[model samples]
Target: METILEVLKKMEKATAREMAARMKIDAPDALAMLRDHEDRGEVNQVNGYWQLTGRASKKPANAVPKKTKPPASKINEAVLVKLLHEHGAMTSEQLAKLADTTVRTVASTLAMPVNKGRIVREKRGNVFHFNVVSKTALGASKLPESASKPAIPVTETPKTASIPEKTETPAPQSSTAFVDTIPQLVSTNGQPAALTPKIIAGEIRKTKSRLVQLEKLRVTVRTQTRLQRSLGL
Candidate 1:
């Protein structure tokens, strides 16, 4: 069965009832189908009517008509930005009038580019001017003029210190030789010490376990925190 959207596409622009009659479906069903298609981003609303978005259907010979592009007077943000770059600076109102768009859009567009450092803002009295800061200007080195000041002279001072002779400290004598006559103590515990391969393998295993545990714990903690905040806990 042909969908309402297909029928609407063929008709170019149609209301719920018109689409329903063309598709042989009830008006409510047609409306529901149209809504679903719209929600899926397959179609769009023009004025108060629904129509298939983008290019018109070429399959149907009797397709109503293709949608005409909006006039050049309707200036978009990109075009406005380009214009601003071409021209020096313009107020939001002036840009809106020039772009044939709302003042809000002009303000928003200006904000994004300014924040990105692609353009710079300057204030003149009460008005603001946006200018594109050239890369050369930003990175250019500032060298002092030779005519400004002469370089200071470097001075060397003579050392007046005296030398000292080195002496070797004597090693400690065996004063504790009397204590060496006492018997030496020994441990009797038989616990097995960790071997080299076993120690290395154990360390690697522990590291892997810690990483996995940390990742899982991080996710769980985030989820729990979100849940707690949502529940006002």
Candidate 2:
């Protein structure tokens, strides 16, 4: 009987007489039912003890199975942009090394829409380098030409040079005074004058000496003013 079989399963291994005693059934009937189960391979007999077979002991076929979850992506746009900003421009291999992932992963993440304007790629030498696009550069690239530089309208005509009124020219000064005013001996267009380091140094020294003289003159003038004020002159 099913009651006798349930008792046998709970006991793990039991003699047919023991199962009958637990189920309160006749020993003969319990032995006959156990013998039928053994023939059907649902139970097995080792020596005089009977036990449920492996197939009969398994969980029911209708039980729910655990579902397998999908793996998550390891890299994203923010992570790649952060790395580019911290390290400046870098190749795919360099980024991969710093991110602790594969080059393909870095490439795929950078190709997404979220990173479109934030990251830019340039080819230098034989390798492609990745850079984080600065806010200023991105905005400049998006600006219209007229917005960046004011455009002159074609309808507006530029003013022409005006004729000067007749006037008397000023008298010429001495060539010596004009020559002294020249800051340095610079090479003019198509002139053979050579501008050497020695010449530059000499000009610098002359200018410094002139500045010191001017400073001394300023101090002397201040002292003279103070003295005159104190003497009521």
Judge candidate 2 at residue 112 and give its lDDT.
37
The positional error of residue 69 in candidate 1, measured at the CA in angstroms, is 18
Q: Report the Cα lDDT for residue 12, model 2.
A: 90
lDDT of 2 by residue, 1-233 (tens): 24545777689998988887776655765676576555445677777778888624465889785353332236677887888889999997898888876665565455532234567778899998989878899899999987999877778655444445478897787854543445456345533346578986887899899999999997898779766766799
Angstrom error of the Cα, residue 202, model 2: value is 96
Please estimate how well model 2 matches the true structure, expressed as its whole-model Cα lDDT. 0.69
lDDT tens digits, residues 80-198, model 1? 66877777687766777777765544544555456556667788789877666677765442334653467788887644343343779976557344223222211134333333677
RMSD of 2: 30.0
| lDDT (0 to 1) per candidate | 0.62, 0.69
Error of 2 at 34 (Å): 59
Q: What is the TM-score of candidate 1?
A: 0.29
Q: Model 2 compared with the native: what TM-score?
A: 0.34
Each prediction's TM-score versus the true structure: 0.29, 0.34
lDDT of 2 at 157: 58
